[model samples]
Target: MQNGSSLSIAERGCFHTDKFDDDGKIKRTGTWKSATAHIITAVIGSGVLSLSWCFAQLGWIAGTVTLVLFSIITMFNTILLTDCYRSPDPVTGTRNYTYMDAVKSNLGTFQYKLCGIAQYGVLTGITIGYTTTTAISMAAIKKSNCFHKHGHNADCHAHNNSFMLIFAIIQIILSQLPNFHKLSLLSAVAAIMSFTYSFIGIGLSTAKIIGEGIGNTSLTGIPIGKDFTGMEKMWKTFSALGDIAFAYSFCFILIEIQDTLKSSPPENKQMKIATATGIMASTVFYMLCGVLGYAAFGNDAPGNFLTGFGFYDPFWLIDIANICIVVHLLGAYQVLSQPFFGFVETWSKEKWPQNKLVTREFSMWGFDVNMLRFVSRTTYVIVTTIIAMIFPFFNEFVGLLGAGTFWPLSVYFPIEMYISQAKIRKYSFTWIWMQILSVACLMVSLVAAVGSTHGLITSLQKFKPFQSVS
Candidate 1:
């Protein structure tokens, strides 16, 4: 068997591949480039916006160090799981089509169900968070326009529910698209939008510093001053760790992304390369945005550089950046949600093999339409949109999700699976070292979880649900 070759004995043919691919599915046309686009679309999201504030809390040394450290950790674990894309053989064995499939193959059937719960839970939260973030970005544009037209001091509060509805309607239509194989163009466009807005943020930050000399900053971070107490500083530093963790949270869908790639060149190898490239590209942007923003505002940096009135003079540029955020999130929502969609549909089909509504696809106009997919997906979008309209708190919850799942999904499970898949001897130096790394990461996750919890609590204390703030 060579590249793109699928060979199985008569007994295993039905399970391995119908003819070309495992499970006789459609052709996997994803390339490393498209995979990179998907990764970028998922990783470089609204989380990047708060990096400057994280920098402000952790300062030049720890801030930059944390960003790079997370990138390395993320890349390492991603490569570990990427190698598990196929079972019995790293490259040519039966495909583990989903994260749960990989878990079941390497770990066990019981762990497979837990992996589904964790992975799908995180992804569901992400799609809901994206809906809120996109709506907020849209509202920010309206707020910016309103503030510019009216005086800044005047009351300008843009309603968010209507904007959320606009997003939901657009998503309902886009959701009709079958799967990730058809989403390469959208992912590429979203990747471009992410880059555009990120560059705009960097440029704005650089311009501000050039216009006005650097603000007061310390190597360690904001020093204890009258306005900022020592206790608050400690909490902010821990919370900043959570923020940085949230910035690199694409591990939730790494396997599914790999499943989309072609068999040639080995999907594991291609995914490893894409993981490195995507993490490096995103890290560079994160450094620039965080460092430049901190240089501009220093201790007084806003949580979101674009939406927090950092540069009100260049109104049009701000509008464009916000619009880019909206566009990027539109694609990100799908990139993050499609795996969850695939999981549910796959389960339903297994349960109801005889139900046409559950498994049948009919050609409509120019597209293939599955009645179950249409109803379920549309209902999902509407439900998430309604939740966004009600609660609408995005960052803290996403940060919490990142912190809570980072150890299990990004570090622990991957390392454990790698050890089992590779059959590393017990108590060997390699196994012990990997275990040590997992424990260390678990401790770090706990710290981040505490920080995220505190932040979410503080935010809720000022609680007014469904209220839009400028």
Candidate 2:
């Protein structure tokens, strides 16, 4: 396999040479541990919080099945992506540092641009989801505290938009963290937060089931045809699949995360192990949270487990969970947004090579700051914050993003790239099975996208901007 030596002196100079060690390998600032932490952080976002509600739509059996299938599919796709990262270049060996780079190399320039669009779009939507979730959790905490201190007549309503704006302002600082490697510590914290909330949610659900009895639980283990028409039920099942797909939709950045690992052949092996560990850990967490939340609330489960149960009992615990969620999202918003920032910066540099606006730095309080980074990232955060405020329905928006982008990026693109790189024959067993899986995923995601889009539009019809929405 080709290494960095494949690059021309000029091209190598353009690269971050400092990142390479004396041994000529890219310095591995991240380890399997950090990679695992980052993957968990990336995979178990606010989407996991909605799995119980997802199960409510698909029932326990289907939801569990979908989650497991997605876990397996995601692991396979991630491995394919890691393989694509080091394709043998005829001239320079092979090296791909980003998803777009891999796409361009394996697919084509046009496909690369298309992938860029989907990648950034899904990432922006994820940032929006994070912001929206932060606001909702904050609002819930505020209301709970107010109701506890004041009577039922207390005006406990807090505008979610206000909290979103505040969170966006906070991101203005967090977004300045520079790069993925720099964000690893934050990612570790975010991973812990994910575990924290998952355990708490599971604990609460278990307690509820124990205290309240199974009779009070929404214990429909399987789907009932009589509850809805076949079509409606199918639509809901597909929608739930989209949610599961989205919950596992971190493949777009897998290469980027892998790039942060120590540069060596073992890096690929390390990534495989990390991917397996992260996916398994997250899948178990999702199952526990989803199953327990469903058993506790049954058909009445809210889209977000944290907000589904009223914030009355164990108010302090709920408060801690919400705080963790808000903080975790603060890190998550950055994890997803950094790629978008890099894309814009790279485009700017290429489009106007001599334009100082793209790289100009100024001093602020004795610290140098990039004007472009501040403006672009802050603007992106503000735009997403506004969208979050407009449509505060977390699950629906998350489902919409998952359905709209997961198929293309997570399933179709990776599998196609794999087949292209591997030269898999059209009728080969592996090729046929993967193609079938891709098509099935695509069809299900399309149905989910349409359903979620309709749901969002219906929500918009009733939306009142800046108003407190339950």
Candidate 3:
């Protein structure tokens, strides 16, 4: 008999309960709930850490409105992109496995190549950011403990590169999971961790407000003063654009997540439901965490909800929250970075379909190992770790990458694909409106990129390469 993968669908139906999909791949078991789990794992990331700061920069009015507006746009764009999962026929046509595949299927080779560069460039930035943040979280845990042991004013300095190395080693192990289909449990756990830390942050913020009273707040945000010069305020407001965008910019992996779903109930329909549900859940949490943190600290809100501000009471809880961040990022790093994984592995497999070194799987500790997967994943983790060690700025990278890729992958491509697939008349009301929306989003991304870049530059002056960041 042929190997399991080569078995005919009818044979597998008789031998196993799992049903193969149209692509003749292994049976998929992803439900809307699991897809939601994946979405949460990807969406609630380091960006969430910076929300309170973004809220502070934009203040009450713009902060609240911007969060809602981004959630709306993300939901709308993802809904459209969801329908583009399957080719000519979204529900029944041949499957497009990755974002690049979807682009090639809908748009053309020219666009596909361009999309790859933008997609992977932002993806690399994101992975590096995650590595840095994970180190910070780990370092915070140690520092929290040290402070508790020797009073709040004790020298609790901790280096982050060692923590970064430890995190990278963990990722190298978890990265062996093979694919998104195998990551359900990890994603679910990560989602729980995300909520755990988020709730803790909210609780701390609430406690501070109750015990200390409300902080200074305004409709227009922080007034120009010793805290922020006029130019600083403008740039910060612009950078906040990226922070908010980063919080909602998970559309790049929407197709990959949707691909994991069972074909029945239609992948598009289920993904749409999952996207809407996940976005709503995250939005509610973001609104609470951001708004409350802002209300508690107002103009002086910390850059990170958990560690940016002064040490919160019940120091143990603060340690737990930071620990949760580390755990959550362990899963999130894989989830967000899977798109690049799929792109590279898929291309390698197709390029050398029969090369045993690249394609052959060997059983080890009940897990399959292949050279392509091993080399590619290990290399990625190592490279990101080195970069994270060199320039460990979380907010700067998140903002810059988020703003850089916001318009193209999340907004522009989806709109362009919708127009192409629907055969809409040129310059019709719908087409004109879509074009206008894309242009508006593009302008927003440009300004955010500038602000984030400025912040990065400013940060660089104080940082030396390979210096241990605390």
Supply the TM-score for candidate 2: 0.91
The residue pairs in collision within model 2 are: 89-93, 218-298
lDDT score for candidate 2 against the true structure:
0.79
Off by over 4 Å in 1: 1-19
lDDT of 2 by residue, 1-470 (tens): 01325344335555465566423555667888898988888999888888987888877667778888888888888887777766653113466778888889889999999998899889988888888888888888887787788965788777787788889889999888767878888999999998998888999999988988642233343345586666665555656666777788898888788878775545677788899999999999999998888888877777788976774567788888888888888887888888888878767766766666666667888766777778888898888888877667777788888897778998888898888888889899999999999998888888888777766776789878767465
Which residue pairs in model 1 clash with each other?
none
Q: Rank the candidates by TM-score, best first.
A: 3, 1, 2
Candidate 3's TM-score:
0.96
Q: Which stretches of candidate 3 lie over 4 Å from their true place?
A: 1-18
User: What lDDT is obtained when candidate 1 is compared to the true structure?
Assistant: 0.84
**Number of backbone-clashing residue pairs for each candidate, in the order shown:** 0, 2, 0
- The lDDT of each candidate is 0.84, 0.79, 0.87
Q: State the RMSD for candidate 3.
A: 2.2
Tens-digit lDDT track of model 1 for 1-470 = 11212333333555334335554554577889999999999999988988988888999999999999999999889989898989868887888878888899999988888888888888877788788788778878887777788867867777888888999999998998877888899999999999999999999888889999787777998898899899888777777787788789888788889989988788998998899899999999999999999999988887776887446556788899999999999999989889888877877887888788887788989888899899999999998888777666765776677786788888888998899989999999999999998998888888878877887899888867677555
Clashes of 2: 2
